[model samples]
Target: MISANKLAGASSSDKYRQIHDAFEKTGRHWLYNATVGAGLPVNHTVRDLIDSGDTILALSGIFSGTLSWLFLQFDGTVPFTDLVDQAWQQGLTEPDPRVDLSGKDVMRKLVILAREAGYDIEPDQGARGVAGAGALRRRVRRSLL
Candidate 1:
């Protein structure tokens, strides 16, 4: 079975308890692909690493379409607030831009990546901080959404 719920291992065990038990009892395999990078094969790569007995200490990347465009459109000349507004107007930001600025979605993806690397941890359980995400988040909160 293949599943791509983008749950990011968030309450995943409980969420998939029945499915997991079914697979365990039936000796069937379950392919749960946590998609955080659109259709990128990051989870697959991590799974392969684990299957090959390799250790992964870290994983990082831009995992949000909204943020990706925002980052690319940003320059030192323009205020982040203006850029955020532009992003919103251009439909490059989330419905609530603050959601993207907060990095929760990205954090969820990170949690999934870590899970793929064999870490049983929650989003809050792990340390999370994006260098400039806070500034952007503040700008988004105060100026836009």
Candidate 2:
């Protein structure tokens, strides 16, 4: 399934799930690499690394161009929500701005990465609570340092 849309994850409501499911199940090999790129096709790289017996600790990158630009424009001078509103007004966000605000795209890509990394992580299971999120933020920040 050559899909650029954010519908490849395990969403039963998603019509294209069958195509992506096939690619995930039987190594159909025709899957289109979309999202979660780190200068290259990161999903394919993760799959390749897994196939070659490499362990994937974490997959990280700026998946959404709009989100990346929004972060760049944020310097705390204006409320972050105000920046999001501005971006939405400028048509830089999805038709439903909540999708971007909720990290919908990024969460879906995270699930895909988890599956490729050989973890049976479902979309719902990918959601970490506030406390877990704080620890994850700390870990990522320390890694950068």
Candidate 3:
């Protein structure tokens, strides 16, 4: 999977090697758009630019879930907490918004982007307790950092 986090301590060459090894198991036919990127078509375009030897000084955009949540917000008159809960229910947030809210999502996204830009980044430990929410908002708040 094109994870939103990089395997820490791995160099650029090492990242590519790891990526190749991980994909080799699924068979050669299973080609992931590694050249592309995380959110969607934009990643692909960025990858194309990189492949063409264009120097990518900086790149930024909203993550997929953030976009999803923004779209969801306009569809109803739900309260902020309820809208956030709905976003979670709809799987728009990263496993848990508590994690997203606590800055883990940003950390992971940054790490992934930095890795893509040829930097050696460390992994984050932000999603450590995003569990046992028991199908309720209480669980989400409890899991926040």
> How does candidate 2 score on lDDT?
0.70
Candidate 3's C-alpha runs over 4 A off are: 1-39, 67-79, 124-145
The candidate that wins on lDDT is 1
Clashes of 1: 0
- Please give the range of 10 consecutive residues that has the lowest summed lDDT in model 3: 2-11
**Which residue pairs in candidate 1 have backbone atoms (N, alpha carbon, C) closer than 3 angstroms, thus clashing?**
none
Candidate 1: segments with Cα more than 4 A from true spot: 1-4, 12-34, 76-96, 128-145
lDDT of 3 by residue, 1-97 (tens): 4443323322244665576676788665323333223435654565577778877787666544554465557543555677777778887666767
Query: Which of candidates 1 and 3 reaches a greater lDDT?
Result: 1
TM-score per prediction, in order, is 0.64, 0.65, 0.51
Q: If the candidates were sorted by their lDDT against the true structure, best first, what order would they fall in? A: 1, 2, 3
| Runs in model 2 lying further than 4 Å from the true structure | 10-29, 76-82, 85-92, 129-145
Candidate 1, residue 64: the lDDT equals 88
lDDT of each: 0.73, 0.70, 0.54
